[model samples]
Target chain A: MASKPECACGDTSAVAGGKKRIIFPCAGTANVGLISNAAAFQLADEGYGVATCIALLGSADTGLRRRIAEADEVVIIDGCPATCGAKIADLQGIAIDQHIVITALGIDKVYERNYTEEEVERVVSAAWEGKGRT
Target chain B: MKIEVLGTGCMKCKRLLKNVEVAVQELGIAAEIKKVDDITEIINRGVMLTPALAVDGEMKVSGRVADVKELKEILKG
Candidate 1:
Protein backbone atom coordinates (compact mmCIF):
# COMPACT_ATOMS: atom_id res chain seq x y z
CA MET A 1 0.00 0.00 0.00
CA ALA A 2 1.13 3.54 -0.75
CA SER A 3 1.83 5.27 2.54
CA LYS A 4 -0.40 8.20 3.34
CA PRO A 5 1.12 11.56 2.52
CA GLU A 6 3.16 13.19 5.26
CA CYS A 7 1.49 16.31 6.57
CA ALA A 8 2.77 19.60 8.02
CA CYS A 9 0.01 21.72 9.47
CA GLY A 10 -1.04 25.38 9.81
CA ASP A 11 -1.30 28.23 7.32
CA THR A 12 -1.59 31.42 9.34
CA SER A 13 -0.87 33.45 6.23
CA ALA A 14 -3.96 32.34 4.27
CA VAL A 15 -5.86 32.56 7.51
CA ALA A 16 -5.07 36.26 7.43
CA GLY A 17 -6.71 36.47 3.97
CA GLY A 18 -5.50 35.13 0.65
CA LYS A 19 -7.32 34.53 -2.65
CA LYS A 20 -6.22 31.05 -3.56
CA ARG A 21 -9.05 28.50 -3.50
CA ILE A 22 -8.46 24.75 -3.54
CA ILE A 23 -11.15 22.32 -4.64
CA PHE A 24 -11.02 18.55 -4.14
CA PRO A 25 -13.42 16.00 -5.67
CA CYS A 26 -13.85 12.52 -4.23
CA ALA A 27 -15.07 11.38 -7.69
CA GLY A 28 -16.74 8.27 -6.33
CA THR A 29 -18.87 5.73 -8.22
CA ALA A 30 -22.32 7.34 -8.63
CA ASN A 31 -24.34 10.40 -9.54
CA VAL A 32 -22.86 12.11 -6.51
CA GLY A 33 -19.40 12.00 -8.01
CA LEU A 34 -20.75 13.37 -11.27
CA ILE A 35 -22.60 16.07 -9.42
CA SER A 36 -19.48 17.06 -7.54
CA ASN A 37 -17.46 17.20 -10.77
CA ALA A 38 -20.18 19.20 -12.49
CA ALA A 39 -20.39 21.63 -9.59
CA ALA A 40 -16.64 22.01 -9.43
CA PHE A 41 -16.60 22.67 -13.15
CA GLN A 42 -19.38 25.20 -12.86
CA LEU A 43 -17.63 26.90 -10.00
CA ALA A 44 -14.53 27.10 -12.11
CA ASP A 45 -16.51 28.34 -15.13
CA GLU A 46 -17.98 31.04 -12.93
CA GLY A 47 -14.49 32.18 -11.94
CA TYR A 48 -14.21 30.65 -8.52
CA GLY A 49 -11.00 29.00 -7.28
CA VAL A 50 -9.15 27.23 -10.03
CA ALA A 51 -10.31 23.68 -10.67
CA THR A 52 -7.43 21.30 -10.03
CA CYS A 53 -7.16 17.69 -9.05
CA ILE A 54 -7.74 16.95 -5.36
CA ALA A 55 -5.51 13.93 -5.75
CA LEU A 56 -2.78 16.13 -7.18
CA LEU A 57 -3.12 18.38 -4.17
CA GLY A 58 -3.16 15.34 -1.93
CA SER A 59 -0.01 13.92 -3.44
CA ALA A 60 2.60 12.44 -1.15
CA ASP A 61 5.65 13.44 -3.18
CA THR A 62 4.80 16.96 -4.25
CA GLY A 63 4.00 20.40 -2.79
CA LEU A 64 0.32 19.53 -2.26
CA ARG A 65 0.79 19.60 1.49
CA ARG A 66 2.08 23.17 1.53
CA ARG A 67 -0.39 24.35 -1.12
CA ILE A 68 -3.38 23.07 0.82
CA ALA A 69 -1.99 24.31 4.15
CA GLU A 70 -1.63 27.81 2.73
CA ALA A 71 -4.72 27.92 0.53
CA ASP A 72 -7.19 30.70 1.28
CA GLU A 73 -9.81 28.00 1.49
CA VAL A 74 -10.23 24.33 0.68
CA VAL A 75 -13.45 22.98 -0.85
CA ILE A 76 -13.88 19.25 -0.42
CA ILE A 77 -16.37 17.45 -2.66
CA ASP A 78 -17.45 13.99 -1.70
CA GLY A 79 -19.93 12.13 -3.92
CA CYS A 80 -21.68 10.58 -0.99
CA PRO A 81 -21.80 10.44 2.80
CA ALA A 82 -18.56 8.50 2.75
CA THR A 83 -16.91 11.91 2.57
CA CYS A 84 -13.67 10.70 1.10
CA GLY A 85 -12.38 14.19 0.39
CA ALA A 86 -13.21 15.59 3.80
CA LYS A 87 -11.65 12.63 5.57
CA ILE A 88 -8.52 12.86 3.45
CA ALA A 89 -8.01 16.55 4.24
CA ASP A 90 -8.51 15.93 7.92
CA LEU A 91 -6.08 13.06 7.83
CA GLN A 92 -3.52 15.18 5.99
CA GLY A 93 -3.64 17.85 8.70
CA ILE A 94 -4.94 20.54 6.35
CA ALA A 95 -7.84 22.73 7.40
CA ILE A 96 -10.97 22.29 5.26
CA ASP A 97 -12.90 25.47 4.60
CA GLN A 98 -15.89 23.86 2.93
CA HIS A 99 -17.45 20.42 2.46
CA ILE A 100 -20.10 19.29 -0.03
CA VAL A 101 -21.63 15.84 -0.19
CA ILE A 102 -23.66 15.19 -3.36
CA THR A 103 -25.89 12.50 -1.99
CA ALA A 104 -26.59 14.51 1.17
CA LEU A 105 -28.13 17.22 -0.99
CA GLY A 106 -30.98 14.91 -2.06
CA ILE A 107 -29.58 13.30 -5.16
CA ASP A 108 -30.36 9.61 -5.19
CA LYS A 109 -27.72 7.01 -5.87
CA VAL A 110 -28.38 5.02 -9.01
CA TYR A 111 -26.69 3.61 -12.07
CA GLU A 112 -27.58 6.01 -14.89
CA ARG A 113 -26.10 8.14 -17.66
CA ASN A 114 -27.75 11.48 -16.92
CA TYR A 115 -27.08 14.02 -14.16
CA THR A 116 -29.07 16.87 -12.65
CA GLU A 117 -27.80 20.25 -13.74
CA GLU A 118 -29.86 22.11 -11.17
CA GLU A 119 -28.47 19.99 -8.38
CA VAL A 120 -24.94 20.63 -9.49
CA GLU A 121 -25.57 24.37 -9.50
CA ARG A 122 -27.09 24.28 -6.05
CA VAL A 123 -24.19 22.37 -4.57
CA VAL A 124 -21.59 24.57 -6.22
CA SER A 125 -23.40 27.68 -5.10
CA ALA A 126 -23.56 26.30 -1.60
CA ALA A 127 -19.84 25.72 -1.62
CA TRP A 128 -19.30 29.22 -2.97
CA GLU A 129 -21.60 30.70 -0.35
CA GLY A 130 -19.52 29.07 2.35
CA LYS A 131 -22.41 27.07 3.73
CA GLY A 132 -20.22 24.39 5.26
CA ARG A 133 -16.95 26.26 5.25
CA THR A 134 -15.60 27.20 8.67
CA MET B 1 -15.91 -13.48 -9.39
CA LYS B 2 -17.09 -10.20 -8.00
CA ILE B 3 -16.21 -7.11 -10.06
CA GLU B 4 -17.06 -3.70 -8.66
CA VAL B 5 -17.33 -0.50 -10.58
CA LEU B 6 -16.42 1.90 -7.82
CA GLY B 7 -18.02 5.31 -8.21
CA THR B 8 -21.07 7.13 -6.94
CA GLY B 9 -23.06 6.51 -10.15
CA CYS B 10 -21.51 9.18 -12.31
CA MET B 11 -21.33 8.95 -16.10
CA LYS B 12 -17.86 7.54 -15.82
CA CYS B 13 -19.09 4.92 -13.41
CA LYS B 14 -21.80 3.79 -15.81
CA ARG B 15 -19.34 3.79 -18.64
CA LEU B 16 -16.82 1.75 -16.71
CA LEU B 17 -19.46 -0.74 -15.68
CA LYS B 18 -20.59 -1.12 -19.29
CA ASN B 19 -17.04 -1.58 -20.41
CA VAL B 20 -16.43 -4.14 -17.74
CA GLU B 21 -19.37 -6.13 -19.03
CA VAL B 22 -18.01 -5.99 -22.53
CA ALA B 23 -14.58 -7.05 -21.38
CA VAL B 24 -16.01 -9.91 -19.35
CA GLN B 25 -18.05 -11.11 -22.31
CA GLU B 26 -15.05 -10.97 -24.58
CA LEU B 27 -12.91 -12.83 -22.08
CA GLY B 28 -15.72 -15.22 -21.13
CA ILE B 29 -15.41 -14.56 -17.40
CA ALA B 30 -18.41 -15.18 -15.19
CA ALA B 31 -18.06 -12.16 -12.99
CA GLU B 32 -20.77 -10.29 -11.17
CA ILE B 33 -20.22 -6.54 -11.61
CA LYS B 34 -21.58 -4.38 -8.80
CA LYS B 35 -21.76 -0.66 -8.36
CA VAL B 36 -20.47 0.60 -5.03
CA ASP B 37 -22.33 3.83 -4.37
CA ASP B 38 -21.92 4.20 -0.64
CA ILE B 39 -19.12 6.62 0.12
CA THR B 40 -18.58 5.23 3.58
CA GLU B 41 -18.41 1.68 2.31
CA ILE B 42 -16.04 2.71 -0.46
CA ILE B 43 -13.66 4.48 1.91
CA ASN B 44 -13.76 1.68 4.43
CA ARG B 45 -12.03 -0.29 1.70
CA GLY B 46 -9.24 2.34 1.91
CA VAL B 47 -9.95 4.02 -1.44
CA MET B 48 -10.46 7.77 -1.15
CA LEU B 49 -10.89 8.43 -4.85
CA THR B 50 -13.75 7.39 -7.08
CA PRO B 51 -14.32 5.79 -10.51
CA ALA B 52 -12.22 2.88 -9.33
CA LEU B 53 -12.24 -0.82 -10.16
CA ALA B 54 -12.08 -3.60 -7.62
CA VAL B 55 -11.93 -7.29 -8.44
CA ASP B 56 -12.73 -9.92 -5.85
CA GLY B 57 -12.36 -7.33 -3.05
CA GLU B 58 -8.96 -6.11 -4.16
CA MET B 59 -8.71 -2.50 -5.35
CA LYS B 60 -7.21 -2.20 -8.82
CA VAL B 61 -7.80 1.40 -9.91
CA SER B 62 -9.14 4.67 -8.62
CA GLY B 63 -10.20 8.18 -9.80
CA ARG B 64 -10.44 7.28 -13.53
CA VAL B 65 -12.20 4.92 -15.82
CA ALA B 66 -10.32 2.14 -17.54
CA ASP B 67 -11.12 1.31 -21.17
CA VAL B 68 -12.09 -2.13 -22.51
CA LYS B 69 -8.52 -3.08 -23.39
CA GLU B 70 -7.32 -2.28 -19.91
CA LEU B 71 -10.30 -3.96 -18.35
CA LYS B 72 -9.63 -7.11 -20.35
CA GLU B 73 -6.03 -7.07 -19.20
CA ILE B 74 -7.02 -6.50 -15.59
CA LEU B 75 -9.55 -9.33 -15.67
CA LYS B 76 -7.13 -11.63 -17.37
CA GLY B 77 -4.43 -11.12 -14.76
Candidate 2:
Protein backbone atom coordinates (compact mmCIF):
# COMPACT_ATOMS: atom_id res chain seq x y z
CA MET A 1 0.00 0.00 0.00
CA ALA A 2 1.28 3.45 -0.89
CA SER A 3 1.42 6.07 1.82
CA LYS A 4 -0.62 9.23 1.26
CA PRO A 5 1.29 12.38 0.49
CA GLU A 6 1.40 15.06 3.16
CA CYS A 7 -0.67 18.13 2.35
CA ALA A 8 1.59 21.04 1.47
CA CYS A 9 -1.21 23.46 2.23
CA GLY A 10 -0.60 22.76 5.91
CA ASP A 11 3.12 23.44 5.67
CA THR A 12 3.38 27.08 6.76
CA SER A 13 7.18 27.08 6.98
CA ALA A 14 7.48 25.92 3.41
CA VAL A 15 4.99 28.49 2.16
CA ALA A 16 6.53 31.52 3.87
CA GLY A 17 10.14 30.28 4.20
CA GLY A 18 9.98 30.87 7.99
CA LYS A 19 8.20 34.22 7.83
CA LYS A 20 4.91 34.50 9.71
CA ARG A 21 1.56 35.80 8.50
CA ILE A 22 -0.71 36.69 11.37
CA ILE A 23 -4.51 36.52 11.37
CA PHE A 24 -6.84 38.36 13.70
CA PRO A 25 -10.55 37.55 14.00
CA CYS A 26 -13.11 39.69 15.76
CA ALA A 27 -14.62 36.71 17.61
CA GLY A 28 -17.58 38.81 18.64
CA THR A 29 -20.80 37.50 20.18
CA ALA A 30 -22.64 37.36 16.86
CA ASN A 31 -23.00 34.62 14.30
CA VAL A 32 -20.78 36.34 11.77
CA GLY A 33 -18.26 36.92 14.50
CA LEU A 34 -18.11 33.23 15.24
CA ILE A 35 -17.81 32.47 11.54
CA SER A 36 -14.83 34.81 11.28
CA ASN A 37 -13.21 32.99 14.17
CA ALA A 38 -13.89 29.64 12.57
CA ALA A 39 -12.38 30.75 9.29
CA ALA A 40 -9.29 32.11 11.04
CA PHE A 41 -8.79 28.85 12.92
CA GLN A 42 -9.19 26.86 9.72
CA LEU A 43 -6.61 29.01 7.98
CA ALA A 44 -4.19 28.49 10.85
CA ASP A 45 -4.83 24.77 10.92
CA GLU A 46 -4.21 24.62 7.19
CA GLY A 47 -0.94 26.52 7.69
CA TYR A 48 -2.07 29.49 5.65
CA GLY A 49 -1.44 31.80 8.61
CA VAL A 50 -1.05 31.96 12.37
CA ALA A 51 -4.19 32.92 14.23
CA THR A 52 -3.20 35.42 16.91
CA CYS A 53 -5.31 36.89 19.68
CA ILE A 54 -7.18 40.06 18.72
CA ALA A 55 -7.60 40.94 22.37
CA LEU A 56 -3.87 40.88 22.89
CA LEU A 57 -3.49 43.27 20.00
CA GLY A 58 -6.15 45.53 21.48
CA SER A 59 -4.32 45.63 24.79
CA ALA A 60 -1.33 47.07 22.89
CA ASP A 61 1.12 44.44 24.08
CA THR A 62 4.47 45.76 22.89
CA GLY A 63 5.85 42.37 21.91
CA LEU A 64 2.76 41.33 20.03
CA ARG A 65 2.49 44.75 18.42
CA ARG A 66 6.12 44.57 17.40
CA ARG A 67 5.57 41.15 15.95
CA ILE A 68 2.69 42.56 13.94
CA ALA A 69 4.69 45.55 12.88
CA GLU A 70 7.44 43.32 11.65
CA ALA A 71 5.27 40.58 10.19
CA ASP A 72 5.49 39.79 6.51
CA GLU A 73 1.74 40.28 6.26
CA VAL A 74 -1.31 40.64 8.46
CA VAL A 75 -4.89 39.48 7.87
CA ILE A 76 -7.92 40.73 9.72
CA ILE A 77 -11.39 39.16 9.81
CA ASP A 78 -14.37 41.13 10.97
CA GLY A 79 -17.80 39.67 11.66
CA CYS A 80 -19.63 42.89 10.95
CA PRO A 81 -19.10 46.46 9.93
CA ALA A 82 -17.91 47.20 13.42
CA THR A 83 -14.50 45.92 12.34
CA CYS A 84 -13.27 45.50 15.86
CA GLY A 85 -10.29 43.35 14.92
CA ALA A 86 -9.12 45.67 12.17
CA LYS A 87 -9.61 48.75 14.33
CA ILE A 88 -7.39 47.32 17.02
CA ALA A 89 -4.64 46.76 14.50
CA ASP A 90 -5.10 50.27 13.16
CA LEU A 91 -4.85 51.72 16.65
CA GLN A 92 -1.40 50.17 16.93
CA GLY A 93 -0.37 51.44 13.47
CA ILE A 94 -0.23 47.91 12.07
CA ALA A 95 -1.06 47.55 8.42
CA ILE A 96 -3.49 44.92 7.25
CA ASP A 97 -2.68 43.21 4.01
CA GLN A 98 -6.04 41.52 3.78
CA HIS A 99 -9.38 42.24 5.39
CA ILE A 100 -12.31 39.83 5.32
CA VAL A 101 -15.79 40.67 6.47
CA ILE A 102 -18.15 37.74 6.90
CA THR A 103 -21.14 39.99 6.47
CA ALA A 104 -19.81 41.27 3.21
CA LEU A 105 -19.74 37.71 1.94
CA GLY A 106 -23.56 37.75 1.94
CA ILE A 107 -23.79 36.22 5.37
CA ASP A 108 -26.36 37.94 7.52
CA LYS A 109 -25.27 39.26 10.88
CA VAL A 110 -27.48 37.54 13.42
CA TYR A 111 -27.36 35.97 16.85
CA GLU A 112 -27.22 32.39 15.69
CA ARG A 113 -25.25 30.04 17.85
CA ASN A 114 -24.23 27.71 15.03
CA TYR A 115 -22.93 28.12 11.48
CA THR A 116 -22.72 25.64 8.62
CA GLU A 117 -19.46 23.97 7.72
CA GLU A 118 -19.89 25.33 4.22
CA GLU A 119 -19.89 28.83 5.59
CA VAL A 120 -16.71 28.14 7.46
CA GLU A 121 -15.16 26.65 4.34
CA ARG A 122 -16.09 29.71 2.31
CA VAL A 123 -14.34 31.96 4.79
CA VAL A 124 -11.26 29.75 4.86
CA SER A 125 -11.04 29.81 1.09
CA ALA A 126 -11.42 33.57 1.02
CA ALA A 127 -8.68 34.07 3.55
CA TRP A 128 -6.39 31.66 1.76
CA GLU A 129 -7.03 33.51 -1.47
CA GLY A 130 -6.26 36.83 0.21
CA LYS A 131 -9.58 38.39 -0.67
CA GLY A 132 -10.37 42.05 0.02
CA ARG A 133 -6.87 43.14 -0.88
CA THR A 134 -6.42 45.99 -3.31
CA MET B 1 -2.29 50.60 46.42
CA LYS B 2 -0.79 50.15 43.02
CA ILE B 3 -2.94 50.37 39.88
CA GLU B 4 -1.78 49.85 36.34
CA VAL B 5 -3.72 50.84 33.20
CA LEU B 6 -2.71 48.91 30.09
CA GLY B 7 -3.28 50.45 26.68
CA THR B 8 -1.64 52.14 23.68
CA GLY B 9 -3.06 55.58 24.48
CA CYS B 10 -6.19 55.24 22.35
CA MET B 11 -9.34 57.22 23.12
CA LYS B 12 -10.90 54.37 25.05
CA CYS B 13 -7.69 53.81 26.92
CA LYS B 14 -7.57 57.46 27.88
CA ARG B 15 -11.17 57.29 29.02
CA LEU B 16 -10.37 54.32 31.21
CA LEU B 17 -7.45 56.16 32.71
CA LYS B 18 -9.63 59.15 33.51
CA ASN B 19 -12.25 56.93 35.06
CA VAL B 20 -9.67 55.28 37.24
CA GLU B 21 -8.42 58.65 38.44
CA VAL B 22 -11.92 59.80 39.24
CA ALA B 23 -12.62 56.57 41.06
CA VAL B 24 -9.51 56.86 43.17
CA GLN B 25 -10.25 60.48 44.03
CA GLU B 26 -13.83 59.78 44.99
CA LEU B 27 -12.82 56.88 47.17
CA GLY B 28 -10.13 58.93 48.90
CA ILE B 29 -7.59 56.18 48.36
CA ALA B 30 -3.82 56.62 48.34
CA ALA B 31 -2.74 54.75 45.25
CA GLU B 32 0.09 54.65 42.80
CA ILE B 33 -1.38 54.85 39.32
CA LYS B 34 0.69 53.83 36.34
CA LYS B 35 -0.10 53.90 32.63
CA VAL B 36 1.44 51.09 30.62
CA ASP B 37 1.63 52.46 27.06
CA ASP B 38 4.37 50.26 25.79
CA ILE B 39 3.00 47.44 23.65
CA THR B 40 5.79 45.05 24.58
CA GLU B 41 5.28 45.64 28.28
CA ILE B 42 1.52 45.30 27.88
CA ILE B 43 1.93 41.91 26.21
CA ASN B 44 4.37 40.68 28.85
CA ARG B 45 1.76 41.43 31.49
CA GLY B 46 -0.57 38.99 29.66
CA VAL B 47 -3.22 41.57 28.94
CA MET B 48 -5.42 40.58 26.01
CA LEU B 49 -7.48 43.76 25.80
CA THR B 50 -6.83 47.47 25.94
CA PRO B 51 -7.96 49.86 28.66
CA ALA B 52 -7.41 47.10 31.16
CA LEU B 53 -6.91 47.63 34.86
CA ALA B 54 -4.40 45.80 36.99
CA VAL B 55 -4.23 46.07 40.72
CA ASP B 56 -0.83 45.30 42.18
CA GLY B 57 0.17 43.32 39.08
CA GLU B 58 -3.06 41.37 39.03
CA MET B 59 -5.28 41.94 35.98
CA LYS B 60 -8.87 42.82 36.76
CA VAL B 61 -10.74 44.58 33.97
CA SER B 62 -9.99 44.33 30.27
CA GLY B 63 -11.24 45.01 26.71
CA ARG B 64 -13.73 47.70 27.66
CA VAL B 65 -13.48 51.07 29.27
CA ALA B 66 -14.94 51.00 32.75
CA ASP B 67 -17.12 53.90 33.79
CA VAL B 68 -16.42 55.87 36.92
CA LYS B 69 -18.90 53.79 38.87
CA GLU B 70 -17.36 50.57 37.64
CA LEU B 71 -13.91 51.88 38.37
CA LYS B 72 -14.95 52.60 41.92
CA GLU B 73 -15.99 49.01 42.43
CA ILE B 74 -12.75 47.76 40.95
CA LEU B 75 -10.64 50.13 43.05
CA LYS B 76 -12.63 49.32 46.17
CA GLY B 77 -11.93 45.66 45.68
Report model 2's interface C-alpha RMSD after superposition on the true interface residues: 18.9
Candidate closest to the true structure, highest lDDT: 2
Backbone clash numbers for all candidates listed: 14, 6
TM-score of chain B of each: 0.93, 0.95
Candidate 1 per-residue lDDT, tens place, B1-77, comes to 99997767765466567778878998998989899887666667776555678999998867554556667888999
lDDT of 2 by residue, A21-114 (tens): 7989998988898998888888777556689889998888989978776677799999999988888888888888888888888889989878
The parts of candidate 2 lying over 4 Å away from their true place are: A1-7, A14-19, B1-77
Model 1's C-alpha root-mean-square deviation from the true structure amounts to: 16.2
CA lDDT for candidate 2: 0.75
User: Which ranges in model 1 have alpha carbons more than 4 Å from their true place?
Assistant: A1-18, B1-77
- Give the alpha carbon lDDT tens digit for every residue of A1-134 in model 1: 44332111121122212146777778665777777777887766543565667676556535776776666678888888778888877777778877877777778867664786788876765664454555
Native A-B interface contacts kept, per candidate: 0.00, 0.00
- Residue B61 error, candidate 1, Å: 46
lDDT of 2 at A42: 81
Given the true complex, what DockQ would model 2 score?
Answer: 0.01
